[model samples]
Target chain A: MRVVKKAEDRKNEILDAVDELFGQKGFDGTSTNDILEKVGIARGTLYHHFKSKEDIMDALIDRYAVRLIDGAQEVAADKSIPIVERIIRVVMALNLSGGSSEQIMEHIHKPQNALMHQKIQKVIINGVPPILTEIIREGIQQGLFSTPFPYECMEMVVIYASTVFDDDLVVMTEKERSSRIVAFVCNVERLLGAESGSLMDVMGMFGEGDESSRD
Target chain B: MRVVKKAEDRKNEILDAVDELFGQKGFDGTSTNDILEKVGIARGTLYHHFKSKEDIMDALIDRYAVRLIDGAQEVAADKSIPIVERIIRVVMALNLSGGSSEQIMEHIHKPQNALMHQKIQKVIINGVPPILTEIIREGIQQGLFSTPFPYECMEMVVIYASTVFDDDLVVMTEKERSSRIVAFVCNVERLLGAESGSLMDVMGMFGEGDESSRD
Candidate 1:
C-alpha cells in the first residue's frame, strides 16, 4: 500500500530528507536521485514539491530564516529579561547551530555554496535589525540607552558584526579575535550611548565556551 | 616590419582596452575576442599577459584597489587638513567614480558580476581601514579622538559603510539615505569619543551634489 500523506507532511518529508542529504553530502554533492531514493518518493512527487535541488535549498533557507527570526522575536518579547541581557540573548538566538544546523552551516560554508551563504547573510542583514530595534527603543525609554536612529544603529551594528567577524571574510588569530570582540562590545556601547562598561558583559558570550556553560 | 613593445606596456595596453570595453559592454557582455580586437593584439599576446578574461578582470580589480588605496592614503597623510575633514576626504577618495570607474562601478553592480563586486568590497574593507587608522591615531594624539581599538574601530566603520551604503545590498529612499548618514556621523563621533557635531560636516559631503561643488 502506498503511504497516503497530506501534501504539507509530504513536502516536509522531502525537505527533511534533503536537509540531511545536503548536510551529509553538501548541496552540490547531493543529487536529485539521492533525494528521491532517501525520501522513497517518485520523481514526479519531488517535482511537485520542488522544481529542483536549488529550489529545495531555497526552501531550506526560507525555513531557517523563519526559525531564526521567530526565535529572536520570542527572546525580544520576553520582558522578564533585562534589556541588556535580552539584547544579548536575541543576538545569541540568531546563531545557527545545534544538530542539523551545524551540518547546514558546514554545507553553506563550502566555497561552492557561496550563493547560499550570501542568501543567509542577506536574511540576517535585512531581518535582525528590526527585532533588536524594538528592544533598543525600550532601553532608550528606560534611560539606559539613547539614540535617535535605533533601527539604523542596529542595522549598522548587525552589518558590521556579521561581516567583520565572519570567518570566511576575515581570518583572525585567537588574540585578534578576542581584541575584536572587545572593540566590538566597546563600540556597541558607544553606538547605543550606553555607559562605558554597561555592555561589557557581552564579551562573555564571545568567550571560548558554550552559552549554557557561560550561563 | 614587426613593432616591439615592452611586456609591461603591452599588459597595460591590454588592460586599458579591456577597461574601456568592460565599461561600455560590462564584464559579462565583453568577450576575449572583443578584448583582442580592441587591443589590436594577437591572441598569443593577450594570453601571455592574461590567461583568460577572468584573469584580466582580476588584474583590473588589483589596479583599482591600488588606485583607491593610494588616493585615500594621500588624503590621510595630509596634515594640513583637520582630523574630521581629513576623515571625510579619505572616505570620499574611496568612492569609485570618475570616467572609467563610473562605468566599472555600473558593470560590477550588475547581478551576474556579484563575485567581482565581492572582490572590490574585500579590497576596500581590508585596505581602507589601515589607511584611515593612521589618521585616527593622529586624531588621538591631537586630542580630537580616543579609541584603544583604532584599527578595529575603522574596520567596523568601513565594513558597515561599504555594506549598508552598497546599492546592491540595501535600497533606501533619498530621505532614508539622508537620515542614515545623520545617524552614521552621530555614531562615528561616539565610536571615536569625539565631541558631538564635530563630524557633522561629513554630512555635507554626502549631500546630493559633487564634492567639488560642495567645497
Candidate 2:
C-alpha cells in the first residue's frame, strides 16, 4: 500500500515538472527525452506515469483549469470580504504571474497553440461568469451594484481585460501603464455599480518584474 | 510624366494587394503567387513594388503604425470634445473593426509576425503618450483636470483601456460588456478630475457595434 502511494506521489511530481517544461519549451520544442533527462528518472518510469507527451499536456491543461476555477471560487465564497476587494482578488488569482500560469500562458501564445488558446479562453469565459455572478449577487443584495445582467457583464469585462491589458498585446512605459490602470479600475467600479474610484488598489498589482530576470 | 505616374500607381496597387492578402492568410500561409493572383499582376510587377515577401510585410507593418498614429492624432486635435469622448475615439481608431486597421491587426497577430506585433506595440507605447498627453494637458489647462502627471496618467488610461476594452481578448455577452464600459468611463472621469457620471456619453460608444450591428 505504501509503495502504491509513493508511486502516485511520483506521478504528480512528474506531471508538475512536465507542465512547467512544456509551458516554457513548447510541445514541439520539448522532447520526451528532455522530460526524462530533467526528471532524471528512467524512461520506463516516465512512460508508466504518462502514456505519451499528449497525455501529459492534457493532464496539465486540465489541472491548470481546475486550479484556476477553484482559486476564483474560494474568493467568491469569502462573503466577509468586501465585493470590490473580492473582485480584485479574483482577477489577481487568474493573473498567473508566477507558478505554472506563466508557463501555460507562454505555451498558449505559441502559433500552433492557437486552438488551445481559444479553448482556454472559452473555459475562462464560461468559468468566470458563475463565480463573478455570485459576488455580483452579493453586491446587489448589499445595494452596492446595479447591474441587470451580472453574468453577461462579467463575460464582457473578462474578455476585454484579459486580451487588451495583456502585456503581450501592447507594451508601454510604466508612467503611461500606471495611468491606464487607474482608467481601467475607474471603469470597473462603474460596471459593478459601485461608487466611482473604487477598486483603485488594482493598479498596484501590476508589478514591475525584476529587470535581472529578463536580461 | 504620365508613364511615370502610372508606374507609381501600379506599385501602390501591388502594395495594397499584398497587405490585404497577407492580412487574411498570414505571413507563412501567403505566397508571392497568391499576391500575383489577387492583384492580377505579373510576377515582375510584384517584385518591382517589393523585393521579397518579407519586404511586403514590413511595408504593411509600417502602414499600420502610421494609420494608428494618424487616428489617435486626429482624436487629440479635437480640443472641444470631452476627455472621455476623446479617449473613446482614440481607442476606436486603434480597433481593427474594418478597413486598413483590420488588415494591420490580423497581420500582426499572425504567429510568424510576433516581431511585428512587438514593434507595433512599442510604437504605440512610445507614440500614444504625446497624443493622450495633449488631451490631459488641455484638460489641465482648462482646469477640468488636476493630475500632476498628465502624460503618465493618460498613458496608463490608454494602455488599460486599449487592452481591457478591446474585443479580441475575451468575448463577453453584451450586457456584461456594456456595464464594463459604463464602469470604465465613470472611473476614468474621476481620475481626470471630472465629476462622477460626467463621462456617461462614452458608454454610448460601446453600443455602437453591439446594438447597431445586431440591429
Candidate 3:
C-alpha cells in the first residue's frame, strides 16, 4: 500500500524527527543518517526540504520562535486575567522548560550550541518585548502602571533578565539566584511604576518545585 | 648598540604594536609577521612573550579591564564630586570611545572580532558593578537613592546598557537612541529610588558633539 503525504506534511515530519534527534543526540552529535532512520525518509526527501543540517536547525529555530511568541500573545490577549497576573502569565508562557521542550532546552544549553543559544536570546529580546509591551500599555491605561516609554522599559527589563539569568553568562549559587530573583521583581515594579509588592507574587512563579520556574 | 629592555617593557611594546595593527587591519587581517615586523622582535622573542595571537588578546583584555576599573575607581573615590555626579563620572570612565582607544573600539566592533567583543563585555559586566555599587551605597546613605539591592540594581543597569547600546546587538536611529537614553536615565532613577530628573544631566554626556557620547 502506497501512502502519500503532502510536501508541507513531509517537511514537518522531517522537522519533527530532527527535533527529537537533535534534542537526544544534540545538533553536532546526531548525523543525517540518524534523522533519515528516525523519520523513515529517503536522503533525497530530506535534502529536498532542507539544503543542509544548518538549514534544518534554522527552520527549527523559526518554529520555536513562533511557538514562543504565539503562546505569550495568547496569554497577553486574555482580558479575563488581571493585568498584573496577565503580565506574569505572559512571561511564564515564554519559559521553555518542562515537558517536551526540556530536551530542547538541554540541547541548546550545551556549550557547543552557543549559536543556537544566542539565536533564541535574540528572538526573546526582539519578539517577547512587543507582546509584553501591549500588556504594559493596558496596565498604564488602567492606572495600574505608569510609563511613557513602556516599550523601552520592557526592552531594558527583558535584556537584563535574559542576560543576568543566562547560566552561560553569569553563574550564580542557589542563594544568590533567589536573591537576584527577589531583586529582579522589585526593580521591575519600579520600572513599570507599579506599587511595591504588587508584582512580588510573580516571584512565586520562580520558586522551587514550580514547574514554570525550571528554566 | 643593543638596547636593554625589561621583560615587562618588551611585552608592552609588543601589545602596543598589535593593538594598532588590529585597529587598522582588524584582528583577522593583522598577522603575526606584521606584529613582529612592527615591534622589531624575532619570532623566538615574540613566542617567549606570548604563545599565540589569542594569548596576546587575553593579555590586552586584562590590561584594558585594569585601566577601566582603575580610572573609574579614581573618580569614584573623590569626595569633592557630588554623589550623583560621581556616579555619572564612574560610568563615563568605563567608556572606551575617543583618543587612542578609538581605533581599538573600531577594531572590536568588526563582525569577526565577536569573541573579543564578548570578552570585553564580560569584563564590564563582572568588573564595573562593584565600583558602581559603592557609589550607590553612598547615595543610599545620603537618601539620594534607596535600594535593598544596590549591587543587584547596578548589575541590572550595567547589563542592560551594555547589551542594548551594544552596536552588534540592537541597532537604533539617532532619534531612537536619544529617546532610549532618556528612558534609560528615567528608569535608572526609578531603579535607584532617586528623584525624577536628577540623572538627566547625564544625558549631556551622550549628546551630539560630545566626545563621550561618540560611543
lDDT tens readout by residue for model 3, B129-148: 99899989988899899889
True-contact fraction per candidate equals 0.51, 0.09, 0.49
Ranking by TM-score: 1, 3, 2
Model 2 alpha-carbon drift over 4 Å, by segment: A1-22, A25-63, A78-85, A96-103, A106-126, A143-166, A169-215, B1-15, B32-58, B78-88, B96-130, B143-193, B201-215
- Cα lDDT for residue A64, candidate 3: 86
Go through the candidates in order and give each one's C-alpha lDDT. Answer: 0.77, 0.65, 0.77
Kindly indicate the candidate among 1 and 3 with the higher DockQ. 1
lDDT of 1 by residue, B95-198 (tens): 53322244445556544454566678778888889889999998999999988889988998888777766545676886787688788888888889898988
iRMSD value for model 3: 1.9
TM-score of the B chain in model 3? 0.87
Residue B1's lDDT in candidate 1: 50
B144, model 2: CA deviation in Å?
A: 4.0
Query: Pick by DockQ: which candidate is best?
Result: 1
State the TM-score, rounded to 2 decimals, of chain A in model 3.
Answer: 0.84
**Candidate 3 residues A66-167, lDDT tens each?**
887777788788899888888766665554342233444555655445455666767888898998999899899999899888999999878887677653
DockQ score of each predicted structure, in the order shown: 0.50, 0.10, 0.42
